[model samples]
Target chain A: MRAATASVAAEVEDLRRRYGAREALAGVSFRVARGEIFGLLGPNGSGKTTLFKILATLLPATGGRVRLLGLDPAREARAIRRRLGVVFQHPGLDPKLTVLENLRHHGHLFGMRGRALAGRALALLGGLGLDDRAHERVETLSGGLARRVELAKALLPRPELLVLDEPSTGLDPGARRGFVAHLDRLRREDGVTVLLTTHLLEEAERCDRVGILDQGRLVALDTPGALKERVGGDVVVVHARDPEALRAGMRNKLGREPALVDGLLRLEHPRAPELVREVMEAFEDEVIAVSFGKPTIEDVFIRLTGRRLREGGPA
Target chain B: MMGLVLPVTTLWWREVVRFGRQRSRVVGAVAQPLVFWLLLGGGLSASFRPPGAPPGTGYLEYFYPGIIALVLLFTAIFATIATVEDRRTGFLQGVLVAPVGPWGIVLGQALGGTTLAVLQGGLFLLLAPALGLAVSPASVAAVLGVMVLVAFGLTGLGLAIAWRMDSTQGFHAIMNLILFPMWLLSGAFFPASGLPAWLEWAMRVNPMTYGVAALRHTLYLEVPVAAGAVPPLGPSLAVMGAFAVLAYLAAVRAAGRKAS
Candidate 1:
């Protein structure tokens, strides 16, 4: 038995990337433990992909040190890549090649050929439930199937560290679920350390530990429950007939005030239901409805950084 | 060693499989040179003759060797654009993140592009007889050897340029600016016999000039010794070898920077 490698799977320290006037990654530092599902959560332009690219040895940092399994990414990139598997956000499969051929080609890159290559490729396809579509051209597959193919390609070498950058972007709901489930299996069965980046809060919650990246800084890093708990106070959202007036009434009654932005009154209070009932009783005619719940990752994000995860999108 | 071979071979095979799927690219690769041979060679044949030309020889024969050089040039240059596309599409990232070193990517691409160039160059030989040019078995083999060297040299140069270019638009613009000057200055389309002293000097220094001269020497069964032409197959091959080494180094460096 090859003794289980105890070294860190990935480590980035004081990493910074500058694109002319803009800083893509600014002093970003993080470490992913061996065999952990680490999630890099951030919205667009928050430097999630940039950080992942640096860890994958695909991009250089302006000033930082990156080590993958004790190998320097800059000087020992090839050796690091041998033990690392990366699934890019975009579909990187060759469009002309079939799914199985894509995996075979990827396997060949790692030095596997002939029956060994073919057997592993087929087994991966079967494991991914893509056996029937093995012969189909990658261009002919749907977005979700193509993403699955990308995953299968990444797993062909059985790499110790699997890096996925927004692996579920174009995937439908079912496909996303299946993909996550498959990744979970990879973590559980194969003991592969997964480093993934995503903008989806729910997906980030599924990770063993989530790192919240906002504007090139890791604002929060912990398990989902711990992060939500840190925010404190259950989230009390008041949907009133006149949000401004109700917000004023609640502010006047509670004397503690709440965050009022874009017609939603959000308050973090220990007795959120009591506060909601007190506000509703005080403004019986003005209040329309009250919804109370424990703070979710989204609320945590909103509280930490005065914006929702999908702020501009359809709520 | 197996680690190196495995990734390089994989990337090379992927490129070949991709080339096989694009029918139009194949046609463009083989057809463009033949068209240049027929149209430009025929048009020049009527009015233009070799300075100390032999009687009864058509313009196609004189232009045939140049067309082979052109074929190699076009294939190699277009392959550079494919590299740019691969980079833009993130496929290059996947390749870079593989176990193979940066040099492996450069070598694999150069080898794959050179193979395609050779395949296209071979088709030109089959079309030679139809153009009233005779190709003996020896000449065919020698021409193929020159084609390999020229293709490898040009592929290295293309990979170097593609690695330097940040965007496809920038790559295409640079290609347009360099392609015509390099082609015309190399004397691929015309003889350098009557060119200005400076222009002839440029041709003498141009790598493509050596490639064209060597290829023409084998294809036309004539000693390549123009006024400013670098004589002997040895010197020309040396220039190409130098280019291959320099371009390969640049490619490896650029790939390393990008991968870093």
Candidate 2:
């Protein structure tokens, strides 16, 4: 299929960032259509935050171009800032102020004030279901409530583009679900374009499209279904005490080589359960356990990058 | 017109609220200069006697203007620490990404810090009578003018320092390294006389010296002696005013660069 049109809300081409001797972003590129909820999925230190910062005009890109609402982020930064709202990966709410005061301060930064500012803040808090706690200090709120306040602050100005970096990092399951639902409501009801970065697979699935980022490079970009279909077959997992030996035996006996990571052997085949039974028969008591399931986003990630999405070590 | 005023006023109000919230900071801002004024002035007065010191020159009287200058200097210098904190806490990021110009952040912070400095200077003025200094209405206004100038210069310097600093520890070190020499050499605690020739030359180039001199002149009605000859107060005010303008421009540039 042909790619979508390039009339995008945010466009970044070959964006690169260097921190002293280290290169944080190396030739990264992506585009988000207007009013689309786009997700950037990557582990820590994968240049997701750097990309977000560059787009927000908080950090200048060392090389390449970034455009938000068709204006260069570098030269037209003030114009871009006027139209963009950014919620950084870290908690940005002022702890000293109440939730309403925090929103008021955020509005003031954008040249808003008085009764209008108060009314807008109240409306935003009301929309976020946080009006009841508006008078409470941010420090007194729970992590989930604070996150909602941050979101409300970002939405106070009714920005054209919203950039959220790991917005649901420390939230509980219910909070994360509610936050995602709120984002969906914004996209559907208000038509606000959202560009979010997250490491959670389920959160990424909620986006209309996902960009899989690894080592500062976008490895894959597609809808969740497309990404999953790219894996081709059911994921057969063969757990063994010695994966190397089992993988070699499977390669030699069944003429099928599976990807072995740690103690789990993963393979994509037409009849995964049948293959699992055959493998069990071939290995007999040698195989510790065997499991088969549909391919997950994690599987796609490992297939493309040769590393688990949540696994740690080197990128 | 109201739109323009609203944003700046709201930002300024937020800073004021933040200052009020930090109880420890309020105490420190006021207490540091007052203690320094009393202890250092009293100790130095007991130990040394000038050959031709002015009459009715108690330690408090001689050190009062310096203490005021110190109040302005310390308040401005320590305000940079708040900037570093704001950066780490994501408040600075929010400000930078706002629709406002970079100068708004710089000007707002300077204005906030200056207001606090002026308030603290007022407290020092109220404590002046107990410290043997006269506080007439005109004298109070004059002292406020001098404090405003000193606050402007120091806040500009603070903004400049904060622009390049990424950590609180680095900011603290730079503040100590730069401000101590400025205060000591500017004759804030001691008269600049009897120093080595080269040291005197250094003091001549220090902007704080002119601020301290102008403040002393306004507060005590004393003429500032430059190179052993008392220069006119107009020249001293002009010198400090020039530094204030230059520092403000530099601060604005630094803030713009930081936002980038």
Pick by DockQ: which candidate is best?
2
| Residue-level lDDT for A121 in candidate 2 | 93
Query: Can you write out model 1's per-residue Cα lDDT over A1-315, one digit (the tens) per residue?
Result: 123335578878888888888998888887888889999988888988888888888887788777788788778887888889999998788889888888887887788789988988888989998889999999899998899889988988889999999989988888888999999999999999999999887688889999999998898989999999986678888777888777677767768577775577888888787877777778888766778888788888888887877666633
TM-scores, in order shown? 0.93, 0.94
User: Poorest 10 consecutive residues of model 1 chain A by lDDT?
Assistant: A1-10
TM-score, cand. 2: 0.94
Model 1 alpha-carbon miss at residue A9, Å = 2.4
Give TM-score values for chain A, per-prediction: 0.93, 0.94
Of all true interface contacts, what fraction is found in model 1?
0.86
After best superposition, candidate 2 residue B108: deviation in angstroms? 0.3
- Residue A4 miss distance in model 1 (angstroms): 12
